[model samples]
Target: MDFPQQDPAHRTLTVVGGGVIGLTCALAAADAGWRVRVLDAGAGERASWVAGGMLGSLGEGIPGEEASLALSVDSVRRWPALVTRLDDPGVVTATDSLFVAASATDIEYLRHLADFVWADQPGTGAALQPVTGRDIRTLEPSLSSRLVGGYRAVGEWSVDNRRLLEALRATATTAGVELVSARVASLAELDDLGPDAQILLAAGLGTAALWPGADLHPAKGEILRLRRTRWSVPPPGHVVRARLHGRAVYLVPRADGVVVGATHYEAEGVADRVPQAGGVADLLADAIEVLPGLRTYELTEAAAGLRPCTADGLPLVARVDARTVVATGHGRNGIVLAPGTAERVLSILEGVEE
Candidate 1:
């Protein structure tokens, strides 16, 4: 994949999809002096719009997802660099994340996770501390009394995805990447842009519609945004992912509100677009069961978004051809992986192994 350098003023890169990944890629390509334009479907709803913005790779990992976990760990490392490059200090939260276990089964499951990560990843194991139920209560008094033990991935951070989108929009505009609204039903139709246009198909789930064999599907997840009174005891100061009765739920706190999510519903045979009542109900129940104070929080918003995923959860960031590249299937880690995905696309453009 050795792509020769083309003069920025002469080469055009049209990215299909205005989500986090597409916008980030536009910014990076603009920085490299390539003429860039982003085409979005103009639909307001998208996976990036509703992501919980958790940067907790250590907490999200499971046994068979080790390969994707490794990719995530690498992406997490690139967050600070992106923040610096974007020169937006307020985009990401400084608060760390906590993996909490609210019952005996949770404790055992978390213990297994701890053992796996500690043995599987020697580099970052020492910093991941095993926490007792008392330690958890001590750190966040709002936690339920029935909690068992969990572990803490110290220094892991979450982003305000809404703010990150704004920041990226501002940065991309400032970098001179043209933002346009266009629904690309056909990849070949984009050739109207120019003869040398490099079409980057970074269109989340929309990629599947453009190609019959595209290895991508949508996973619908429902999340609730709860608001607290300024005077109320604040929710957990950090991200808390709990495994209660074999179900996993996470509560991500932000200045605007606490993000309680998420219930995953896999679309079996066809695309399921709408939010399910059962999914929302389960997330709310699980979230409240772990932290009692959330019961009093105002239910500000309930929304569902579809995450583009591959069967194995690995992102597709390979060259479709010399002039086309596909980047999607990031699943739940799209926010955390956007910077690294941008890096990967740039590498492909430069004809390097991504």
Candidate 2:
């Protein structure tokens, strides 16, 4: 549906999608004293519900990704205050992140990345401490002996995305944002000429169906969750990652469980369903190599979701027209980028340049 222009007299905003982006937009808009409503087709098994919730913009950034890096940095900076305002305890964890390289070339690549990041801010690269195998094991006792060297990036943190989603849902409800559970038939359904009424399309992969030729597609990611007690070994103190041949694998530990994931499949026309057995086995094998003890962990669940991806691997947060704003194409960084993205959307609605 087309959203009307922002009118000082209008109060209602109909937000499409109840995923991380949509919920965050609703909460932010409500905080700004606007009546908000959220709509979603899938209440369960959404990408936001299944994400590992790592907030590491440094680790996720690729070379020449200045825009994404800027957005991620901004979002990370806003996380502390945003979580405090939400007042949701256990939503954020301040554990540092470890990026390990199994080979000499990978270590050099990491060093180059560190150098580039440091070049942006003098003396900041000193924060990433170089580590030996001994240090790696000492830092995270669960890691295997196969790793050569790694670097610890302090201040890189993670959040429990499911819990964050729950908190946002609660806050939206408290703020009186209406929740609608149904598939949106079309964007035209949200069209309105009123200045204050806005239609925000924040659904992830679902946005593709609403806006044809948006040049968005899905990148499937499969994750496996394991029970912590099945292994006799201690858990890693921080998140563990391995720069593998083609893709990277991450081990995210939580109080309730440990998440081992994920594979980024760039195939088209794939269905959004539960993770396949082969994919789960592949992820487990990768995790087991990083932490051999994970082989003994009891498998709890396997899930897969389509991360909304764009051609340039960046997010699209702009006004498609007068009544509609597109905010999808977050890919795997939806949880990490929610706050900053919402702020930008609010600014756009208020006619402020980002």
Candidate 3:
């Protein structure tokens, strides 16, 4: 299906949702000389706010995740150029990520993941090097002496999501992107708009609400922020993650604070809820086990956000109708996947065959 050629002089786009995904689309469209408006319900806490912002492509590798892996890598590749264009202070930060495994089972899984990436592309997985306990300690002296072994993914990076969102919002404003604080009840409301007007459904889980049966679900993730001074030992310069009993926890250190998270719960709905004490306790305990120094850190804040999940786990960036395009279901890698998704959306809108 081909969309009508939008007027080059004044293309108007209405994006639903103000989270990272929606904001990204709005910014990209606005930068392309489109008049964009973002509509967000602004009712509850969003996932973007609570994210740890780790841009881990290899670290998130799982079987049948090839599409996601490709999207992540492409997004990382575009960071340099994208950051330069944004002029945002917190656009991105290059930091290595460590994935540690304590038990034999988890060790095998980590190795398999590392091998999968390496097998697919030799140097692609160079960042993920098999390391021993001493090597881990040499890199991050603050780690607990209990660590057995792990892999260091070197080229990984993270973005301060709060700052990125702020920057995107600011850029959108500067580009004349209008932001409306209102929950979009349905996608039908955006139906059959004029040639100059385009409707983009970029609302995370809210996209599912608008188009019932849309392949989008919410994956609840809880995160905790810790004050930097609370730690007796200095925080790790790079993000640290450990896999225990098949579950994973990550400790991300930023300039302003350290974020430790997260717990994936499929049963939870997309409601705005303060992070549970139990969740924070679990994250703290995991962080301490990975790096004992974190035990001294004081909890500054706890929050929850629902990741937009899909059946295939790949983002949906397709035109659902003549005037409507849908982009959602980014899962845990929303920040990492935003650029690639935006590029695809633009391609489809421009009638480029994908």
Candidate 4:
């Protein structure tokens, strides 16, 4: 669909949601000479706040999901420039990630994933490297002595998401993007912005509430934060992902501790925001198996955040109408895909095909 060219002197955008995706897009639009305002409810508990912040384009890839994998690979490549533009180097925590397996079943799954990326998709496979148990332990000495193998995804970096959010907000403010603390219960409430104004629904789970046909549902995930104490062993030097007894878990290293996560389940038709005991238990148990020293670390936080997911696991970043754009359904890859999503939004506003 083609949009009548918008007047250059009157490009106005109102972004709903103050999370990573919303802020990232708002900043980009403002920099492009668009008058932009971000409306957020200022909720303290959000998926962006509780994310593990893994930019694992390769580690997170799966077989037969070529479209999403291709998007992730392309998005991860744009992360360096995004972070550089943010001017907050301290927000990045890890430059590499290690994927490990404890049992034979886990090893088989890991091997299958390795083959899928390395053999099936050569472009995406370049980020991955198959490694033995010794190599895994050699790289992250704090990892368990369990017998198995894994892969090392080079340049798959992670960031301090909390810091990143702050940097985005600060930078966006500096760029003249208005950050309004208000809840927009419906798209009708935004009609006061005038018909010529562009409205972007990038509110994660809240996007569906604002617009129909969004095809979005919430996937609740629980994650734990462990702070290193004097008695606790040092955190791993890299992001450590593991599959144990069919459960997927990851331990992302921090300067002072580690972030362990996560347990995924359908959150549709449910309103519970509290972290489930079983989910938290499984995350801790599996994290301990991967990094045994977590027993002595302080359990700083146990939080459940809702990821807005689409049925096919691919994000929706397209123009729904000439004055309306939708950029949600990022699922668990919102941070990894923020830069690319922003780029797509700009292209849509300019009526340029991507």
Give the number of the best model, judged by TM-score. Answer: 4
CA displacement after TM-score superposition, residue 125 of candidate 3 (Å):
3.3
Give each model's whole-structure lDDT.
0.82, 0.79, 0.79, 0.86
| Better candidate number, 2 or 3, judged by TM-score | 3
Supply the TM-score for candidate 4: 0.95
Steric clash count of candidate 3: 1
Q: Against the hidden reference, what TM-scores do the models get?
A: 0.94, 0.91, 0.92, 0.95
Summarize candidate 1's per-residue lDDT along 218-302 as a digit string, tens digits: 7878888999876566867878888898899998878866898887767653346566889888988998888887877888988
Model 1 weakest 10-residue run by lDDT: 266-275
Cα lDDT of model 3 by residue, 188-270, tens digit: 67656565688888888878878775677787778888766743777688788898767789888777557888988784566
Can you tell me which runs of candidate 2 are displaced by over 4 Å? 1-9, 117-126, 191-195, 244-247, 270-274
Residue 221 lDDT in candidate 4: 89
Which clashing pairs does model 3 show?
41-183
TM-score of candidate 3 versus the correct structure, residues matched by position: 0.92
Q: For each candidate, how many residue pairs have backbone atoms clashing (under 3 Å)?
A: 2, 10, 1, 0
